[model samples]
Target chain A: MISDSIANAPVPAAAPNPKDFAKKKRTNRSAKLKQCKLDARREQWLSQVKNKGSKDESNGFRDSSMHERDGSDRSLENLEMRQRGEENDGSIHHDSDLESPSNSPTSNASSVLGGNHSGTNYTGSSSSSSSSVGCCSGCITEEEEDDGCLDDWEAVADALAADDKQQNPSSDSSPDHEPVARSDSLPELTNRVDSVVQVSKPECAVMVPRAQVNGQAWRPDDAFRPQSLPNLSKQYSFPMNSDRHYGRGAVSWAHKSVISAPSSCPICYEDLDITDSSFLPCLCGFRLCLFCHKRILEDDGRCPGCRKPYDLEPVEGEASLNGGSLTFRLARSCSMITRS
Target chain B: MVDFARVQKELQECNRDVEVSGIKVSPKADKLTHLIGTIPGPLGTPYEGGTFEIDIQLPDGYPFEPPRMQFSTKVWHPNISSQSGAICLDILKDQWSPALTLKTALLSVQALLSAPQPDDPQDAVVAQQYLREYQTFVSTARYWTEAFAKTSSLGVEEKVQKLVEMGFPEALVRSTLEVVGGDENLALEKLCTV
Candidate 1:
């Protein structure tokens, strides 16, 4: 939301010299876009590391066909555009877009509409592809595992169906069909598949347009049942147009539907780092990221997932940052320390 | 704050299944904290066919704090105030849960329209009529729904014409509708008094 204001905040009351204001805004936008890009990439790495657990668990719910749609190089573009859609829900009137650059709604639309695939995709703007994360290699391996997980899910789903009568529909549908049959179920499985796809496809292609991203992240987000984004999160609002008319609601909806990397927080719908420590669960099994879980705890100690108050006593030897178990905190801190 | 992100997701989620729920929520303006929700009046009730609008105000602690909802469109019901439009529904007050989104809360409000609790009344007059003069209450409630529900949506000209067709002079209908801010039903009620 901060990036939206930075990129799209209306002119100050004491409007500056038009030319100077335009230049200043341009410089500010570029810097913000660059920072946002880095943040998106960094957040991507953090989520990937945090979500190592998602690979095995998140697979059962994903549509295996969406992996086929994972067009590789959209990463950098989506990394930037997706965040733009997430934080910047302010209307992106065409006039304002013309004046601002980078995080302008126009830039996101341009990328999402396939306008920049050849020339100015976010990857091209990023010069440091070989950074410590070995950006390109990490992304490739992630996609490779994404495919591996698809195959894994196919067999695992079959195995689960053979074992359990109530095997989840998402798991069983695939591995039963050739890849062609799988595509037919795409529209129906899109919601569940997108959630799985959100987890596995995180590294390479995050922007399926939230039309592809909606509440597919946290299963318990569906606890509300009446109004959960899990199924609708995949719609990227089609027009990420900076139409001054589109509020932040439509923007994030647009953002998630377009490109979602991390599994999203059920409460906020912002991408979640879904690790055991980052993603906390209620006794009733409602899962939310630590940020929202902590906020709920602070508010009334009621879990949004279960509508029941949770036990606040911290677990043994674990001083929680919020309500989570913090099993990986030491490992994360060590890694952060070593990396920095 | 209002957890605008969740509000956004809720908006997307709620509007997506509008066909099923027949409930739609949109921001009153840019602020997610204030919203306008529309619910079709419950079936098999005096309210059927009318679209009721609800004005929603999200407290800073929303989802944690129940969203404050009152009818924007006037309605005659035991648990809802006719003058102030304050709703005396349990879910809107202490019984609310974070698990409840605007959509679900609105659903409960719609449910209340069908099954009213005259014993726990927000408007004593409406409750008294409901319990004492059951037939009078249904007609009055139905009349109120017709007048209240269609008032905002019907154009002044259409209302003027409708009243004119009902035997009022065209000039009288126009002036009366204008006096009542184009509320044809109110105009009709006034013309009868005249």
Candidate 2:
């Protein structure tokens, strides 16, 4: 497009002074030629990157291996499955860290209470000794064993299915249960293989609670249900936790789409965390996130991304979502949770 | 970037007359843009046979604000003060308009040098000399123009010495001179107000 515009521009006639004419011609020709070459190189690089795979990979989500797989003959779904396995391993390690013996304050309290009830005001002296032997070593090994059990994908799937059934018992007997049943019946698809292939369906549900309790939100039922994984995939077509790899076709397309898309956070190179992000709308259909919007507003109440004036009217409910009106919402509950 | 299209159009019209007349005006920028203007000092004056250089600075709000002009070369006249090289002219102040171009402003400054408005004196002493000792003032103005403002190599210290000799106190004169930014008469008036 740029090359066509340059080619279509009319050339000027010769000047009276040959020396001045020569200088002007040299400057104009070099500048236009340099610009054309740069644009061509950019277009070529973009096409090469785009041909590699799904657009999400370029948007800073795919890992190095997934990128290499996309570049090779391997399918995007298979590459996603392998990436999910790696992510599950990481989650397991995180779970173990949280569930370690050193972290079990409840067990230690129970041991102290048991000693106090036994009339051994000797509870004080025995508490220290019992805690070291009966709790520390024993609990550590028991916790390690529990962690090992969680490493199995089948067990994790069963646990999830069980939890789902417990929470939505009515749905278990309904026709809507077929999707869940179908998902569970295929144990081979346990490693998020189906989810990866059926990527367009928004499987991940995020229900941001609107109220706060003592500065922390009451823990939601699905708080631990792997929210980041699906959210990242929807936005970039790759795992959220993976270190970015720039090579894949999908990754490049995602990057171009994002870089070209107006609302993307310049700092994180991710879509603005929509739940918490504020919006500044312009006539150009460019919506800047709160951070970028604020910076530009300070200079002039104009959209930095599009260089157009913005009108910041308060939008109510879901009506604001229409016509690309930027909406702001709190992502996480801000209620305080106190265990009795 | 600057609106190069507008700048190019303006430059073309500006250079047309100068190019035809075999005179040259080159646009250059250092601390500020200085339009180095060369014109044969008009005939029949004491300043005849001497070339003069005028320095002009366009303020940031150009077109809206007037360009500041001062004679880089020294000259003496009833209107051109030898003390601070100040030219008593209305176009440099209230008469300025955005529509006025650099070439026109420079031409006006040249015309002011040829026709001195000594009655509205910036340098009262120079005006007095022009009234009382007309030939002496003209001779001194011509001598200074030949010695100072005529050449790029003329030291600023020599110019300062000539201004001091014109009855301007060294300190008040320096402060006033600096205040007007090398315009001697305005600097003296500003100093006097303090």
* Best of the candidates, lDDT: 1
Chain B superposition TM-score per model:
0.81, 0.66
Candidate 2 local lDDT, A218-330, one digit each (tens): 23443323343444335555544222332233344444443445444532223676532333244443444554444444434444344444545433222345433432222
B1-194 per-residue lDDT for model 2 (tens digits): 12233334445666788755423455554333445555557777777766776666656544334566666556676676665556667767766543355666667767776777778987788789888898898888788767654543334454456567767677766666665555443343465566
Indicate the residue-level lDDT of B75 in model 2.
Answer: 67
Superposed by TM-score, candidate 1 places the C-alpha of residue A305 at a distance from the truth, in angstroms, of 3.3
Query: Which parts of model 2 have CA positions greater than 4 angstroms off?
Result: A1-340, B1-8, B19-23, B30-32, B149-194
lDDT of 1 by residue, B50-104 (tens): 9888989999987678999999788999999998789999888877877678999
True contacts kept of each: 0.70, 0.00
Error of 2 at A24 (Å): 78
